[model samples]
Target: MSTTTSNHIGRKISRIRELRGMKQETLAEAMGISQQSISQIEQSETVEDEKLEKVAEALGVTKEGIKNFSEEAVFNIIGNTVTNNDNAAFFNNYPTFNPLEKLMEAVEENKKLYERLLKAEQEKNTYLEKLLSK
Candidate 1:
């Protein structure tokens, strides 16, 4: 039996981040760091545990997930899911949602929520001002 080697943690993080449709800039913003720092972190072979945890949070994955990620394995799973009719019932029930698309949808929903909150706050302040004027 052949043993499989794990990819470098940094490389795995980078690949997962990309697959999740997250830009380095967005990750940096979430982590309170610069985009350049994100780039440097991705190039490093290893990252400190604390920083890795923060990166995992920003990328919406567990640290363990990033550590164990395998691009080839993921693609192989996707390929099999697409080609196998045996699993059609499951796929039909679940609809084979793409992770990247889900991430994008989540981000959009967050933006809308933020905008609505801002608008509500503004309206509340305006009402308060009118009450104060009387």
Candidate 2:
């Protein structure tokens, strides 16, 4: 493989990792490697295929997907879809749900449920004490 292609692949890996909100230390922990090793991998122009496969798995992307990744292409696609307001095309092309947002919403709803349950328990305890005193 050309040096340029290898360099691009390494850079792509780094970019995708950052976009996924992953720190080098976090990725290292996930892959059972050292943070320095993760840093070195990010800086490398070429990685062995086995190592590359492990990195891709840690980052939650396919090996081929990482090899072919392009930030500019992603931005262009998003720009076109958002600026054009062609909702149908955009929906058909990419996933609409944000997993993080959904998780946060679920957590908030659970918090509310917990609070209600606590209030009911307190009221029940108070009623039981009144009955016992009588």
Candidate 3:
């Protein structure tokens, strides 16, 4: 029998996150962790139970869901659901997209961008002042 690294918990989590259309930064923020920490966790082979619990919550999935996640199954479900004519029934759990959440994400990104731009401008002004003094 061949050994299968396919059961790696980190890989499962990473794949599930991708399936949920979530970025590492988003998950990191939800988990109250640094993005680098999320990246590190994704690269790990195994995570502690407490950390895994936090990750599952951040990902909006149960721990069992993460553990049992299957890409093929996800694709198959999507494929089957999309073929149906009733769009409403296809999404019985929750809507695939949430406009309010998307709007908030956009707002947060814009705020961050503006903050960075402001910082750059401040640095430029400081440099100009130093040059004038010289």
Candidate 4:
């Protein structure tokens, strides 16, 4: 079992399962494995080749498709083209962003701004109506 892309593979599996709208229980049953096993596999730090093949079959995808499946692969593939210093610059420019935190903040800010704008629009409309009536 190689640990190189265990997390990556697990994420890919989860994404594929979600895309197919298949529950973890369903996938576990189809693969003849326990639900816990499926969960562990999806969260595993390293996965066996046989297990990978089984997962690919169950997902109706190729092993390479699962193994090579990620935007991170783009970084990994371009690794040789970057030096230590160059890579440091890249990471500095685009530090890893947490999805949940960033999204939550954006949503809250958008809600506040949207409410403010709507209120202002309502006030403007009321003032315009009064002026036009007069």
| Cα deviation of 113, candidate 4, in Å | 63
Model 4: residue 34 alpha-carbon error in angstroms? 0.9
The residue ranges of model 1 lying beyond 4 angstroms of the native Cα positions read 1-6, 84-134
Compare candidates 2 and 4 on TM-score and give the better one. 2
- After superposing candidate 2 on the true structure, give the runs of residues whose Cα lies further than 4 Å from its correct spot: 1-7, 84-134
Top candidate, metric lDDT: 3
Predicted candidate 3 versus true structure: per-residue lDDT over 1-134, tens digit per residue: 31123677888888888878999999999988899999999888788989999999998899888777777787678778686566666557966799899999999999999999999999999999999999
Q: Write the residue-wise lDDT of candidate 4 on 1-134 in tens digits.
A: 43335457787787777767999999999999999998998887557899999999998989888777764564566786677855675565654888899999999999999999999999999999999999
Task: Give Cα-based local distance difference scores for all models.
Answer: 0.84, 0.84, 0.85, 0.81
Clashes of each: 0, 0, 0, 0
How do the residues 40-90 of candidate 2 rate in per-residue lDDT, one tens digit apiece? 888877778999999999999999888887777677777876755655655
Candidate 1 lDDT, 83-129, residue by residue in tens = 65575755466447898999999999999999999999999999999
Superposed by TM-score, candidate 1 places the C-alpha of residue 13 at a distance from the truth, in angstroms, of 1.3
* TM-score against native, each model: 0.57, 0.56, 0.57, 0.47
Candidate 2 RMSD computed on C-alpha atoms after optimal superposition onto the true structure:
9.5
| lDDT score for candidate 3 against the true structure | 0.85
